[model samples]
Target: MSCHNPAAKIDIPKEAKKIVLAGNPNVGKSVFFNYLTGLYVDVSNFPGTTIDISSGKLNKDVVMDTPGVYGVSSFNDEEKVARDIILYADIILNVVDAVHLERDLFLTQQIIDMGKPVVVALNMMDDVQRNGLKIDIELLSKKLGVEIIPTTAIKNEGLDKIKDALYRAKPGNRIEEVKEIIDKIINKVDTESEALLLAEEDENIIDRHNIKDFNGQREYIYKLRRYRVDEIVDSTVFEVNQNASFKTKLSRMMLKPLTGIPILFVTLYIMYQAIGVFMAQTVVGITEEVIMGKYYYNFIMNILGSLLKDSSLIGQLLIGEFGLITMVPIYILGLLLPLVVGFYFFLSILEDSGYLPRIAALVDRALTSLGLNGRAIIPMILGFGCVTMATITTRLLGSKREKFIATMLLGLAIPCSAQLGVIMGLIAPLGLKALIIYCLTIFIVFVLTGTLLNKLMPGESSDLLIDIPPLRLPRLSNVLKKTYVKSIMFLKEATPLFIIGGLLITVLQYTGLLDSIASGLSPFTVGFLKLPPEVSQAFIMGIVRRDFGAAGLNDLASQGLLSGPQLITSLVAITLFVPCIAAIMVIFKERSWQESVLIYVGSFIISFLTAGILAQIIM
Candidate 1:
């Protein structure tokens, strides 16, 4: 929605003032937002973008948490959104990282130039002090002509001061060069902020004002403002020593190839143990076999049977093999839920501990071979959570070609946690050798596909230019809260898809289409993949949901139908197959229908061929 149209997404009262929380990336803006809004919050997608905007109440004011950006301009989707919100804000709570003042003050200067009432939440004061640096806050405040509230947001320090300072907020002094330009447009615009934006040639502001285009003098203004920021820092900031702290030393080790590679593997192994063994085997077994299968499923089936006999369509639809009540709940709640919780828990820990960016840095060199940089690691890691969401995150990558390559790789080989859990459980019985083979096969396919796409896809991959946040001990409350939120989101998004898949299966079974398709694919399934004809059903289910296919294989393995080599072959094929229908639809939405179709068909052919070759050798 347009920033001017707060009624579209925000539920602020007509008389309520707008308080915008603004900041550079990773500067504790979200933490501040949470503290101000508490539990009263609404998150919705911006009208035409995938970016989510969060709005909530702070006392009587409507507080908005905007996307993190460096300076307010239409450089990208995120910057554009943040700029719009800034333009419309009555008062701006500009959160700044004390440790990264040199980098962050650029945005602060931009906000000040907008002539908006602003209160600087100088966050991360603890980190700043720990790093042997100190800021003369009073002096800095006088220099910037704004209230600077020193805060350690995670610790809830200086939060009350922020609220108290809000009423004391005043417009910051404008940059001299920008002021001259603002004077030129003073009659054209009502506020200095609008004039500054107009001088920057912001298209949205230009359109709103119906003003003629002016040559943007953004670079000249930026350079002048940047010099002033340097002067303020030099006069008001102090450093005791340049010694690297322990966290910095550790961060350095994580960037080196030798140490970083081992660290990466150790991290992945830990994740696998947590999700694969603990959650998949132990937790899932308890939930699926004992609670659901032994007790809940039986109880539900008995109740359904009593209500409608087994021969009835309603009874079959409720408790039959592909029944909504039986399969949907069992698969979603029992099988996938534990895995989702476990995966998100570990992911939240890593994210909160600030190690994910280090991982991106560590893998940057290797990813170059895949026609991606470290930034692509974000989507790849996210793919493990949910390929559909990861598909949307591909926007973070640089070019269409990089996005295409990343999307293709994700579709071809990345298995989401739910599918990985089932695949782990199914293959765990075959011994470590079998699991190793399965992993190796998928890795080979991933590397080969990425390398081939790198060669064929015509474009240059962007270099990695990411800000590395300092490592901090993860807060248990924050980690748990994140896990809960992400888990709920996963359930909300995945439940309907699982239910729909179950319905599709039930319809196919009732019409004998499932059997017909299985029979038709027997030659390839049985002859080439060396899998039983029934395993063909899993391949079909893969299109509906990748984990559904893996779940189907789990059922076959449980029934003693799939042997060691056959199990490996089946898992390999399914893992390398196309992602779920949701991901394909997202691909179509993000890219083009032609690209989506090509990804689907290409993945299928590659998966089948790879599985066939591997099956012959293993057999």
Candidate 2:
């Protein structure tokens, strides 16, 4: 069956062409896929493979990406999956790391030998220059008999041409011996790709065809492909200089303890000023107070007031304090958009510059003490952006123990960026003491939780395995595009959930469930935490979302209902509160139900318990 057939489990249109992206690992295939297919793509396990394959529609054509593999064979599941995808592809867009052509070209040559139309993206052109190497692009293209486009994917350069070059892609140079063998077997196989695989005596293909599975030429074919790749690389790539570039020197500085620590601190300070201070303070005031609060609120109210009864259920649903239309837009556009956008922009630039990996390397030893390798820091850092996503990312951990420990810490302590934005806005008015106390408290919890889990968990974590990308100057166009795409996507997905949360809160209020729950929790809220019963409402909404809960406290603070001590207590409690519903669901998906429940109950108990103690200390 064709890959687009129902057996492949994809819904490609009948007339649509299939373009499969093939590359080795860490060659920027994903970035290229996103650019070609857009931000939101459908990801699923490819048939029986455990690994996921992502595909998206581009105009009428269906573009899909395969797992990065060295060659098309059944040596591993990744290779097997890529082999199958390549066999059925109408065209192959092979992403070759320009810096690693010595290795990448092996795959390129093998794919070309399969008699497939191929377009090679000579990716990481900037990294090639920084490494002081040059590629004879024209000669390489000639050697492979394919169109090779040089692309600096992160810089958003040369990508536009790849889309255009798809039309010009054609079969590359095939080895004479392989071609002769393929010509003999081509009659028995469904495609040229299969014929090449059959020529190499691929056991899987041989079985599928039920032909003679005893051909002894596999080793010869692989040996021939390697020799050809080496010949092509020798003639087309040159080392212009061996001297270290500025980026090289900087990467060295960033990996060393003395320099990296200070650098990390400066980066953190800049991030805080941009996202926490400037965005939380100045920009929010205009978006939240001036535009949405003063202008939009008034405009909506005027229209709603003249049209419907303010006291009716429909009025309460539409124009109520917790109304979907009124509260949802205001909270999303006015409050969260600027803060997330600023943070994502900063994060994009940081990630593009290749500093995030260095940060991981710098903190690897410290993480080891917590029963995790340095790679754990990546998800922890990502937790600040979205614990839901960071939860999913814990799959990268080598052991269940590390994932459990990391998930526990993230759920209990790390505040998402939007929540942090609200926290900063609330605490800024109360001075440095409140800020320090919050940070110190959360930090202590994070350390203690990880340490305790380390001691209690049964297994050991895997050693740090990481690939460090070359450091380079971030491109403005790339950063801005990332920021804009990510921010808009966040809002688009979040708006419906926010509306549901607001509507649920409104219904609970009208039906008295909200008040009743508050009443039940009043003893702890009022007596222990020294907070009002209304604070219970924040915790209730927190189960829906961490930021919504923080925004609830923001509502209380604006109404002058919380004193400095009470505000600090509430913020700390909510900060340590259960992660949002999405994160909880993801945690459940990533781990057993027993582990998920433990995290959930543990978070709630610890959040309140910590706040109660802090309430006495500060209140």
C-alpha TM-score for every candidate: 0.69, 0.66
- How much is the lDDT of residue 404 in candidate 1? 93
* Candidate lDDT values, in order: 0.86, 0.86
Report residue 115 deviation for candidate 2 (angstroms). 30
lDDT of 2 by residue, 382-454 (tens): 8888888789899998778898999999899999988999999999889988888988988888888888999
lDDT of 1 by residue, 473-572 (tens): 9999999999999989999999989888888887787788999999999998988888899999999999999998998898898899988898899999
Clashing pairs in 1: 1-47
How large an RMSD does model 1 have?
A: 9.8
Residue 219 displacement in candidate 1 (angstroms)? 14
